[model samples]
Target: MYTLILISTMTNLSEIRALVLPYYEDVALICAIITALPVLVGIILYLSKNHISKPSTPKDAEALVEYKKYFTEKELEKLEVPYVQRIENNIERDVIEEAADFLKSSEQVLIICGESGIGKTKLAIEISIKINESKELTGNFKFKGNCLFANLRHYKNPKDIEEKLNAKLSEKTVLIFDDYQYNMEVFNEIKNKALRRNSKLIITTRPIFVKALKEKIGEVSIRKIKLGRMDINGILKDLEDGDLKKVERISEGNPAIALLALDYIREDPDRNAKEVFQGIRTSKDFFDKIIKDFQKEYGEDFIEFLAEGELTGGVANIPQEYEKTMIEMEKSGHIAKHESKYHLTPDVLSEYLINREFFSGTILKHSFEELARADNGTYILEMLNSIMKIKDDREIYRKAAAKLLEIVDQLEPNAEQKKKRIKTGIMVYDGFGSLNLVTEKLKEFWTDYDILQDGKDLLDLGIFLIKISKPYEARKCLEKAEEIFSKNHDKVGISSTSHSLGIIYQQQGNYEEAVKKYNQSLEMKEELGDKSGIAITLYQLGNIHYSQGNYEEAVKKYNQSLEMNKKPGDKSGIAKTLHQLGMIHHDKGNYEEAVKKYNQSLEIKEELGDKSGIAITLHQLGNIHYSQGNYEEAVKKYNQSLKIKEELGDKSGIAKTLHQLDRIKKDMDRLKEKMGEENFEKAYQKIESNNK
Candidate 1:
């Protein structure tokens, strides 16, 4: 009976399995189809999107051919010869890399903005090349298209831009509008079409147009890259040192102007870069246009005020009545606002404005009192210095000197005012005026005021004269100051005058006299327990020792100064002492020691926000690397140094760093020739990879 029951159960189970098996199979089939359906649909969509048919008609083909030709012409075939990569910050990332990333992202428009002649157009072209090469793009949306460029300045009417751009707008293309005029209506039309077609656009424009462009674009996806001055050391390798300095001064990082200056130099080899730049017809025309526009927009009064502001180191104290005008100027990128003051843009424009006002006699029209009231007469002095630097005409200098002398004569006999007048008189004589005339007038003028009354005034005047390279004049002032201070029993004043005399003698290459004076100051500082003053005197003594090639003596003095500075927590003094020690080591060919010292100094400078010091240290580090034949490392250090120097507007430092870079380039070229191209390339790649 049990066997029969088992057999019956097995048969019933088998029947139940047969019934469920078919349904299970159907469910599995449905699951498979559901899983595969989305993928199949994606494939279909991709194929359809990518494999659209082209126009087959003859007219369409011809039109397509014409468009291709136009685009080919518009495309930047390659970067300009001797292109210098421009970095926006201390980071190694360049503008081209940043712009390429923007293109790869969802941003539909990239605007390159900067001052005129700051290479905005060149930057745009570089970005175009980067996009075409597809080198930096690593994103979901990759650009695979023709890069086309157009200068909007060539297109007079908005309608014409619309018509020309219509043929170029597509998913597989990018259009760059160079020198965009911020035509909102035309941009809107093009942008709307570009959005629908999924194309990107780039605009190169002056910073003045950026605000209008943004306001016009509204909510459209956009990005902006601002170009600044780049290291043109490589480009200027052929220039003489004098010419290089002249170009650095005038170009102010504008490569186009630098090149133009170079061309002028080539044309008239006798004329220097400054002379060529001053006489450039194009620059004159450009300034003429700017002056005319400014006069038309804001009137002659505004221009005069701007000239005054320019004279005062680009700062202008805006009155309430002209506040609105200043706001407009700031928005237009003609000026920058800083704490209730407006600074003129491009700084170079200051030269033009001052020259214009001076030649027009607009500057002379102001009362001496009015001029003196402005920044304690700094504007008048700055105007004179600027005119002296730009103009070679002795007649112009004489006229300016006469005006300065007149202003000096009107100043009150107050100690501070008298010092200023005397300084101005000395500056006039030093620059262009007759020394005897200025001296006799100063002598007569000083007789009216008792110089012995204020030792501080005479001391200050002595220091000022020292700075202006009039060591003899400075010595006389210092001697008188010392006498007055001794009579008044002013120990601090006497010590300072002694130190000033040391600096004067030191600068004149009289190490023995400098040492004697420095010893006198040092003794007084030690007696008064003036730790900072002692450190400073010791540092000056170290400099004297260094100049005289007394390495051991210099090191001893520097170490003593360093210890004193540390005790006082004078970070600046400490950094400077460390830097001096590093220089000694560098001169001694102790590169390792030099680097260590520089690094120590660099740490403090970085902490203190001492950009100038940091630049100096970085350059020193580059020198060490160069001496050690670490060319790649040397270049990295140099670039780091150059970036800081450029930011600080240390034109001389920039030129020096560039000179080093040029040297490195020449060295590398020689190496390449010696090692053969293939071997050099392999070695360079190895070094680069290792650095990465």
Candidate 2:
């Protein structure tokens, strides 16, 4: 039996040991001595090979056949990454993260649902990348065969699904099904196959699919995530003023449409709103070009209609001659009508549709005049609402919107009017969609920034910039803002500035300054009955102390935050504070206490759907395994953390994993050397030098 095993296998140490153990007692001392030298020498040879051998890391990866079998040369080249590509995803960062957490730890099955253009594709990609990281980190990234990324709408039927899954389904692999909303039975049958075979199954769809699943498979069979539109805040903050204007001019906030719009902006950097709108259509036809396409379709009618409709009837109304063209345009997705009027579809679909009028509209000057002359607060609000919809010349909207706010505020004839204007201004601010407005407004606070108001504008701009993470500018803005607030006796603005400055310092690792600013903010909030503000400041102080390694002091500050009269979000803040305490315990080598604190944080994070926070805890738990010399378990935890990081595109966490992986490899080499290798010393030296 041993001989048969030996003939079939290159080497089976356990079989050899089993065969030899039975014969050891019968051997003569001289015979044993004579045989021992050769056996010892063979053991040394085997150990030496295991200890010194490296994994299949290629010199020029392009030469690697194994890699070529599964990936394109481009994929294998391991594209140079400068930093995490900043993706302003349409879906909320938190929702995607929560779904990812379940995908990493659960049974490799998930369903993500959202409306079209709501970022289902992005979320799927995020989850897949993360799982890929997990496979890579654990030294198990073999895809067995290939990866099949498909839009399920075109490919339905259980048989087709099986054929595709069989085409690539291996022991270790993942499949991403995008736009999988059209067929419910095909999806379930595919999911069932992956489950039976124990492989990863990811499905992306619109919300309609969830209903189909519920009706066909019953509640017990459905496990899914629902997605929403791009938060205006996320979109705005992601773009610079120039890009923000471009996005507004093109996509608005729809992820798919936004991409289409961005491409056009790249091609025609100088195109105006009317010119852009002219080209914005989804159908690929004569109407695709801005100036010529629509003209060919509608002839002189399209032009005379635009001249009469936009120039004469005002944007609030449309001319009668273009009414039929407008319906056709709407059906083709060239023009969008919301409240009995026409506006250009977002920039994404603009290339497919033509809106030469919208693309050519004089946005910077003329758009502002139309807005200013528009009737009461409600009418102005309606016009402001249309700013994001118009797309293609966003700077026009920003300057115009800011001016309108200033103009309306100045015209405040009574107390009620002032309140209405302020409310309308905030609506415009929020509706302009994102941080570019805040950043633009705050530009007046720059070294050479010029705004007529000496201090009020700067103070408001400072607060706005702080919310958007423009720290460098925030500091300058806030400093001037504080001086102005002090001059005008604006106690509220002063307090706010103090609070914001403290957060800036704390984030930069300046604990001393952070604490000082918090103290002043705390005093002001207290006098003003700002209980919520007090709690938030206390929490910031706690984080600063924690970063400085002051565990006890952090706990004290956290307790103060807890003592204040705050709201639901504060509960998550408290959980974070507890998490910081867990780290301190983990660092101090109190494994049990650390685990307890971590478990507590995990519960809160789960409840809160805080995926980033959960990933952090997973990373911390991995340390416990390394501390105990349980390398396999340690690698497992690290792999789990890597999966979450990948889904979230958390770059810092990826870097940390790479740094720690060197240790795991070295440890494995050391164990092999200790077995019997005479060249163990040389192997250790090679690994050490390689690490350096």
Model number with the top lDDT: 1
Candidate 1 error regions (>4 Å): 1-121, 124-128, 137-255, 258-277, 285-301, 308-320, 327-352, 360-379, 382-421, 425-456, 464-476, 482-495, 504-538, 544-553, 556-583, 586-692
In angstroms, how far off is 243's CA in candidate 1? 14
State the TM-score for model 2: 0.36
| Model 2: residue 231 alpha-carbon error in angstroms | 26
- Residue pairs clashing in model 1 are none
Model 2 agreement with the true structure over 613-670: per-residue lDDT tens digits: 7778877777777787766666766776776677555677778876666677777677
Please list the residue runs of candidate 2 whose C-alpha ends up more than 4 Å from where it truly belongs after superposition.
Answer: 1-472, 507-510, 563-572, 599-618, 621-654, 661-692
Per-residue CA lDDT of candidate 1, range 73-125, in tens?
Answer: 22223224446756332334366667657755677667776655566656655
User: What is the TM-score of each predicted model, taking all chains together?
Assistant: 0.43, 0.36
